[model samples]
Target: MILGTVLGLIIFGGIGEFSKSQKANSLGQVKYLIGVSYPNLNGPWQLQMNKEIKNEIARHDDTRVIFTDAAQNDEQQVQDIHSLMSYGIDLLIVSVDNASTLTPVISEVYKKIPVIVLGRGVKGYDYTLYIGSDNQLNGNMAAKEAIRLLGNKRGQIIEVEGNKESLQAEERSKGFRETIQRESKHSIIETINGNWLKDRAEDELKNLLKSGVKPDLIYAHNDAMALGAYQALKQLKIEGIKIIGTDGLNEESGGLRLVKQGIIDATYITPTGGTSAVQYAIDILHKVPGLPKKIILRNHEVTKSNVDSYLTEGDNSSIPFIKKKERKIKLGFAQVGSESEWRLANTDSIISAAKEAGVELILKNADYSQKKQMDIIRDFIKQKVDVIAFSPKTEDGWEEVLMEAKNAGIPIILSDREINVEDQTMWTSFIGSDFVEEGRRAGKWLVSDSKLTTTPLHIIEIEGTANSAPAVDRKQGFNEIIQQNSKFQLLQSYSGDFTLDQGKKWMKQALKTYGTEIDVVYAHNDDMALGAIKAIEDYGLKPGVDIKIISIDATIKAFNSLKLGKMNFTVECNPLLGPQLMKAVKDLENGIEIPQKIITAEETFDQKQSKKEFSRRAY
Candidate 1:
């Protein structure tokens, strides 16, 4: 079977030269060489496979795992396979870049050494084994739920699909449309291409809405699209429309969390099966009987009712593990100075997490100096630490120094503030609160209550440090939300340098400029809000009553203010990221894959909830 009709790579040339130069081991052997080619190492799903496969390889004494990334290039994958075979790899596990273009290599490689195709299937390839979930079956399962949502009544389903070129998109779409047509009266009114991106899905769904279709229910091929579709309809004043999604990843930013938070109605679990794939490979190596040619791991729907089983916070035992090492992990953390209570909390969170995980953390405060931060990072490199993490002072001027660290073989993690490096591979992972979403939550809370929406509410935004990611993105998100309603007006917005003193001075100026006209004080953090509260009191006005105070970073101080009726509302920006960072570092040490961007889950709080949450608040 020739799955690839377009490829023209010559595999025989390399095989002959390599065989002449080196001795190929016989079939029965004590040692084995396992080669795996991942699609790319950036995504959460891809990282899971990398983790599981590497873990499986680590469990064996005589096995050596050789890894190469196709980096989403089909041609490069062909070259990578030939390179692996040149080293006489005993077995090969490949998540092909493109099933069609890379099928020729799969056909050639399986004949020499056993090959296990990772995720997708080629059209006409007979591989040694196939271990992955069937997207078409996942789509059919989604349709089954859609039928139940309709309950034998007629309704419309708007599907936000992945890219049209993708096989997963085609299969999921075909299965869904066929099932809907055959089993139920529900019709797919519109199917738009999202390119498998959240922003694209939002824009496409908005364009679909412009054509005047308020769907009865929506089924997105992925969770990001479903979330985007939800956001689009929400902005258009549509509510209560059920949405279903795929790839129920178990992370803070993934579909399982979305289901837990009620952001999306449902999502299907898509397994990485890296461990299972490697296990089957080991099984075949030992000639275990009754092994199937194809293995489809089961996937199920995750919704609000059964989401706790998939929740990370509720269970500490589920934290991903690596093999125990003799040396305690040595980590260097560069903080952006103690500018506010939030910074203090974030620093404490990192330290506490390090302490709990038994990691020896070397701490340094850059005092908001980009040069000083770079120097501190270089000092870590000099110490030859196991890993380095930092909250960058600014976005720019990081590419060169980061490249140096990467060259030195130190994995870097960005904590809170992001860097604008040219090459993204310079850093390992970014684990922090999404500042834009934090701002959106604040603005959404401000406008949610009907009583506050009655009149034109003039808002004074006390921003964070100038040009910092949190400051810039928080302003952007807040402005985007408040601009939706004409009743909300931004009277004045200025950066307070994310300091309490600056916040007080800025508040005084804003009050002087607009006397008795301020209806809301929207500070980017709790420290600034506390400063504004002091200014309000000094000016002979009661805080929270005269001016409805809304802020971000629900720290203990902010919660205390809320308890005292000094602060009305605050959105949470959790800074406790030690555990998450430790997990990534451990995985990196063991040659596992980690996501490019890891976001933390947060919540919005009113004065009433503050009373109950103040005691247990860690940040």
Candidate 2:
């Protein structure tokens, strides 16, 4: 078949004279050639195929094969095929760039040499053989699995098709739609094209979200697309969306590894085209005929329960050591500085948590200075710490420090303050509260509990550190809620820098400025509220009597003050880091990967609830 294709190419003047001359001269030599569909080397599919092709070539003692990446260009692929044929390659393997556009090229090559097409098959052409997984069946399997895991509910499913122009993508969507239809209970609310690239898939998914399409289950044609969809869900702040995809490669790392880590629900097996193509090429070289015209590998679904089966010890293992080694882990911490009571509590918790976890902690205070934090990080590098943990003073200045740590092969974990680092490759993970959500909860509680009168209620806010992430996020969340209710008006605002003395100083100033105007005081942290209480009492205003109080960071002092009726409401920002920090460090030491962010669960508390849960509170 390949010989016929090559003859057609020669007759049509597709092959250059130089190629023809080479074909005539190298007729007796053992030559092999492979034509790949896309030139993207970073793509998992391309990398997998490259590995298998190289392995197959190494197995043959007298064979030499030249590889050509068509880079998803049809004309370039046709030219590559002709050049390969001209080189007198004994076996020709081709993965089509475009199934339809490459048909003529495949037909021409098939006339001169055996042509085995990899991945998506070409139409209007008969070849020596075709090898690829049944994409449609894989898609159907993914839908079925998603339905089964989702209890066959009638929730919306979003199908992310790869390269809408590609035949495989069309087939996959068809099978998925058909399967959902047959299930009767399942529904597909929307479908978007991912283009089989992570960045493009994420952008498309984001656009879909903006259009008000909320998907319960996101099914992508490939793992890369699935991961992209997951990222979109995270960015949109949508939770409980189950994601599934195809290509069960390695579950311990890469896309499959993410699946095992509970990032995605499952993945279906779509055998790498490279392995089968190379195997078939070798068979043809040995004069094997009557090979299957179409080769389809069985599809296997990989879920969390069975993910470990696909992860070999050597393949997905994070730690190479079989036995536990007693090595000291030098740790560096760049705190948000002692700005708020919560910040101090968080810092103290980290120190205490490390001591309890048995991790050698090398602490550094950024002094709320980004430059100082960067310098501290450099010091940590000089100390050669095994791991570094930091709560960046601000979001932007840590890139240099992060790079230095990265270069030194130190894994960094973020805590408390969220640096504006978008690169997931930089840090191992983050562990802290969802500051925005925490603020939202605080706002909702305040709005729900406050007594509504005909008069607009006056509120005075004592904010934490002005530049800190939590302060910004908490303020934003509070404003978002307050804006929804016109009855609630912020009379005045002042930053106490999260210190008791500053809070007292600001409260005194506010009292002198807005005498009887302030009816309620909302402090970002409890310590600030405690200080404000002293000022209120000093001004002959009875605590929790003349003006109600609402504060966050339900520390022990905050709870105790609530019991004394000094504070009206205290949102629980449990500072108990022993359990969570220990778990994170242990996982890292054991070479077990953790999630990118670990949000500590929290709840709101008022005087009534605070009294009931105070004794049980660990922090």
TM-score for each candidate, following the candidate numbering: 0.53, 0.51
Candidate 2 structure quality by residue, lDDT tens digits, 1-619: 2443444345322454423223322334334444433424455765677677767655654455556665555677677677676657666777653677778878887887788777777763357766676677677777778778778468788888876556788888888888888885878888888777878899999999999887789988888888898899899999999999887677333556877889898987576667667766777877773234455554566778777766654232221111244775556776657766567667777888788778788787877777887888788889877777777765665666687777777777777667765343466666676677667777877788774565777889998877777778888878888889888899888988778898899999999998778888988888899999999999989878788888888887888888889888877665554456556667767776544455565667888888998897655
Summed over model 1, clashes come to: 0
Count of backbone clashes, every candidate in sequence = 0, 20
Off by over 4 Å in 1: 1-326, 450-452
Regions of model 2 farther than 4 Å from truth: 1-326, 339-348, 615-619
Q: Would you give me the overall lDDT of model 1? A: 0.78
Who wins the TM-score comparison? 1
Candidate 2, residue 370: Cα displacement in angstroms equals 3.2
Residue 461 accuracy (lDDT) in model 1: 93
lDDT value for model 2: 0.72
**Cα RMSD of predicted structure 1:** 21.6
Query: Among all windows of ten consecutive residues in candidate 2, which has the lowest summed lDDT?
Result: 314-323
Computed on alpha carbons, the lDDT of every model, listed in order, comes to 0.78, 0.72
